[model samples]
Target chain A: MPEIMVFAATGRTTEQKRGLARDLTDAMVKNFGVPAESVTVQIIESPRDSKAKGGILFCDR
Target chain B: MPEIMVFAATGRTTEQKRGLARDLTDAMVKNFGVPAESVTVQIIESPRDSKAKGGILFCDR
Candidate 1:
């Protein structure tokens, strides 16, 4: 089984994540021969201030 | 080829993302029998306010 983890800032809806998971899993199965059911995709949503670059947070960027 | 997309909140360092990519790729190879070079992992950092749920953003979580 192939496991995939995706982290997104907390603003997208659950439906979006599900869509992404579905599309990504489908792509992996079709292209890489990985079984559709064997692919695991997870989305981790974080806060804007939880991430920063050059002293600026993602919200600032 | 298996294309994997990882979205981070932008707080993680490049090294961290690289490490994650390396580990994820290695796991895929060792357990899922995927070619190391053929597994593509990408990290996308989004703004906290770019996503929302229940009328609130991820940063507020």
Candidate 2:
């Protein structure tokens, strides 16, 4: 199974997440010949405080 | 920067997650020569209900 994981700051609508899942599945099927049923998309919502960029926490930026 | 994402069932202990983050970062540093500081490990916890296996939702398993 192809487990696709995406991470971003929290707060996407359910529709966006669903669309992403579907898109990822389609891409896997297209490129890797993986069946749609075997592809999994997991979206990780990271709190700003827990993520940093360029020496600054996302929460502080 | 290497953005490594891992997808697994919810309920890993904090220690396990941290260890995974460090291990992933180390691997990236060793193989890709990316600085450990530039590596990001995002752990995605999928709810059993939202994830399916063999056309069946994990919640039922």
Candidate 3:
């Protein structure tokens, strides 16, 4: 199963998220040659404070 | 760079999320010999309706 998981800070509209999922699914189906139904795309959004980079929280960045 | 991404439906408490992140970081550090700071854990939470399995939305399940 090809499952695509997207991680990012929260802010995207539902439409944007839907488009992203669709696009990603399309990519996987085209490249991996998997059925669209077998491809699962999940967008995981976190609050700024929950994620960090280079030892600094995203909220602090 | 070892980045850990967790995908799950929303509902976890802040403390649980924090603990999960910490534990995952520890695991990566222990197994991969990566520095604690080098390990990034991001929990991506999706609304129930946004995620689906087996052609059915999680909210509907």
C-alpha TM-score for every candidate: 0.49, 0.55, 0.58
Clashing pairs in 3: none
Candidate 1 per-residue lDDT over residues B1-61, each given as its tens digit: 3445754344555665666566656644554444787677876677776645467876896
Q: Considering every candidate listed, which one attains the maximal lDDT?
A: 3
lDDT of 1 at B56: 82
Model 2, position A17, has a per-residue lDDT of 61
lDDT of 3 by residue, A1-61 (tens): 8888788888899999889989999999999999999998887678965675443456665
Q: Tens digit of lDDT per residue, candidate 2, span A1-61?
A: 8776676776666656665666777778899997878877666677789878898988899
The per-prediction tally of clashing pairs is 6, 0, 0
Fnat of the models, one by one?
0.11, 0.21, 0.31
Best first by DockQ, ranked: 3, 2, 1
Residue B44 CA error for candidate 1 (Å)?
Answer: 16
- The DockQ of each candidate is 0.07, 0.18, 0.25
List runs of model 1 lying over 4 Å from the truth: A53-55, B1-61
Tens-digit lDDT track of model 1 for A1-61 = 3456754456756665566666666655554455688677876667887755468887899
lDDT of 2: 0.72
Off by over 4 Å in 3: B5-39, B43-61
Report the Cα lDDT for residue A59, model 3.
63
User: Tens digit of lDDT per residue, candidate 3, span B1-61?
Assistant: 6997777887887667666776877788789988888877777778899889998989999
